[model samples]
Target: MNTPARSRITAVLPAHNEVGALPATIASLRAQTIPPDRIIVVSDRSTDHTVEIAEAFGVEAMETVDNAARKAGALNQALEILEPEGFVLIMDADTQIVPRFIERALQEFQDPDVGGVGAVFRADPPTGYLELCQYLEWARYAEQIERTGKTFVMSGTAALIRWQALKDVESRFGSIYDEQTITEDMRLTMTLRACGWQVRSPVECQSTTETMPNVPTLWRQRRRWYLGALQNITEMGWNRVTRRYIGQQVMLALSVILMTTLIGLTVASYAVNGFLGVQPFWLVIGAVFAAERVVTVWDQPWPRRLFAALVIPELIYALILQSAYVGAVWQKLNSSQGEWAHLGTPHKTTEEV
Candidate 1:
């Protein structure tokens, strides 16, 4: 008779002063349909009650004294304690998994070839204008990854990894989450791909994270992300999978370049034809941007979804992100080392992360 396989799963939540969101995140894990065999929360130099809260829920909590790589360091410390033969999940403390996230994510691991599974991250409940914009942008990003049929980056917000793939990654980088890079998720994706491990994000494995409350914080965050992306690409070298993703980013960069060209053309038009040349270009751009939004936001409600088609907000939002991309390219060109700055999260009196 064949023996039934036991679910040897360990989940690690690396938190640094994340008291506001930790309670709910822990509660969701306890309520998982396929509950993790063990749940560990690593307190990464936390000054608040992150460890206490984890202990309160009967979850094992370990504190990291002074490891440098931030989240990556905390996670590596936790992984060392967890058994290697089991599957492991790394989740951001601010994120809350959908009710059936474990059920949905585990379904993908049955494939054996799938080494890592990521969740489709959504904003918890966007309250402000910028928050809503971020919501729409994330929804579109989730849609794009799903359509591509190959998810390159398994978000740091939520990802489940098979033990073997973690081993493969550790063998290459000395740590599952590399301390050498700010964007550990992207590096892990490249490493796993090179090792012939499949990574994916199923729509059903939905999760949510807090959005940056303001534009400045959002800019800083994205600037780091894009800069790290460029660093990873340059460091990893263009391979088959990385090439496809890089191609899209390169096109996005070109769009930024194209906008500059458009501005110059508009000036030339003013000098030659009283701005007549740029009007045609403006009309074409308006139609295309509107149409793009309409298609992308179809799943959203009516008027709010209609906002996706609006010229001003949509263009302004795109410009902000494009500016971040431009900033990233400039920083990368200068060999500037980037930092992880996920700021503007809700803070309690004790000041949570």
Candidate 2:
């Protein structure tokens, strides 16, 4: 019997003022069961000690002058400098990979048809109340990924991509990471599929990442995400008649629109009932929806499950922000370009783990 060959993996970390998160992230990479051949951390105009921290880890640290395209631009800048030879694993500075994350992710690419693979992501443990709420939401995402091999989007926290597949798409689409789009991960995955490649989420690979730990931060983060989703749909041109990718994009857009509209209508009904002395059925409906969400995640542990049960409040918040973002996206689809506000910055600066 012959043993299988090992895969060559290169990990890329795109950093911008991530001094505090850099140490833990680097340590996580160092602690990998099957270590990467090379770890590259691209410092995108950091005003902090991000590059210094990366160098301290004995990893390759490269600094770039421009921070124009945000995370996607940072990633593409890294790609430009690094030679394209093997699998590229792109991760955020705040994300910590599990011991076997890379080892397992590489295994999926052994199947040539798989162009990219996403890992099961969980929020870092011992988080705050709001963070726990975010964790439960991610848990639902993890469940869906496990059930369906097809993932609608690949998380930037931890994703493995075949170099050849990336090159193929980049050659046609101009750049693997689109600087114009806010949700580069979704855009790249969609582009890959458009060019005849399959993207999957593997069950084995897992990564732990930080989540917004407060209501205000979570609101801003989700709003930007919703806005980005709208931009991606328009940029890709949501056409059900032409391609399945377009159809999928359209469905995703409509779902967002529908959910936002439903939430807005429910809220409006509650206000109207209070003003006109009408029945408060909408409030009752909202309560029922909240109860249903709580019931769905009842199997989790005490506090965790309790937190999950209170998802309605979070959902309501998300819907309101998403509705506003959708309107903003509609108005600025042609020229909406901005840096994603770093929500975990406070935690990153204060917390040490």
Candidate 3:
């Protein structure tokens, strides 16, 4: 068992109509090995039973009348009312933590220089095939976090950020409450780095959260994410270049663009070959890529992992979605608009607390 230290820890959950999942998420928090000094839930214009549910859990709840700014605004509002001397754990109401997650994260912040830390996030299980594919994608992400202490972005689902770090640039980095763009995580990460802080993911801190379960939901999520990335790249281009932080962003952007082009070309080539009554070399290339994905997913079970390994289909879908998102991003950039379209509702699930 981990002993609670003298250091005060505040857990903040920015919620919006999260009544269905908040109960389990709060239960997991109550079961934490190191109980938080304060548990605050920021209710963002929730028309549901969110406020009542949070009261039932006995957590301090504050409602925001003007939720025009979305999550960042909700979080900042909570921050304004909380004691800022200790660490702040920013979590989503849809996620549940392992017993040791907060304890482990607190220990990591003891390093002093660490500004923020993220956890190993697993998408909720017993989902459909598409959801399983998302889980595999998250698994790969977790591996990357373990391999490199530096993560390009931190998931809001389970992130422990220093209060001082947040306060330093919270006001300078634009309106925190405005719901513009889907890439708030990336912007926050960049802001921290700009303030001379490092963010990391400790392997022991684990959290499970739901993922989009179907192609349509997945497409919308990815599109918003891509759009956010593009907006961030444009807004902070100079900061990124001067700080030498654009390398990874550029590489990822290029990779997505290249993948999209390759897939489109391959499809066009196959169609032309069919018309000309000849075999296409593009088919051979596609087969080789598919084989690589299959080999990559080989460590897992037969059909599920194999289905997850289908690189071509996934890449093609990503390209189409990202292309449309990029267009939306460009529109926002040109018009100087900084708000995101709410993608209806997010899928929710729970794991053992």
Q: What does candidate 1's lDDT look like per residue over 130-187, in tens digits?
A: 9889999888988887787668688888888888898988897677887777787878
> TM-score winner among the candidates?
1
lDDT of 2 by residue, 276-336 (tens): 3435896687678777666655656777666555666566645655555565565465565
**Order of candidates by lDDT, top first?**
1, 2, 3
Regions of candidate 1 where Cα sits further than 4 Å from its true position: 1-6, 267-285, 342-353
Q: What local distance difference test score does each model get?
A: 0.80, 0.73, 0.70
* Residue 212 lDDT (model 1): 76
Give the per-residue lDDT digits (tens) of candidate 3, residues 153-186. Answer: 7677788877777776665665432246456667
TM-score of each: 0.92, 0.82, 0.83
Screening candidate 2 with a backbone cut-off below 3 angstroms (N, C-alpha, C), the clashing residue pairs are none
> Which ranges of candidate 2 are over 4 A from the true structure?
1-4, 126-129, 239-299, 310-312, 330-335, 344-353
Q: Between 2 and 3, whose TM-score is larger?
A: 3
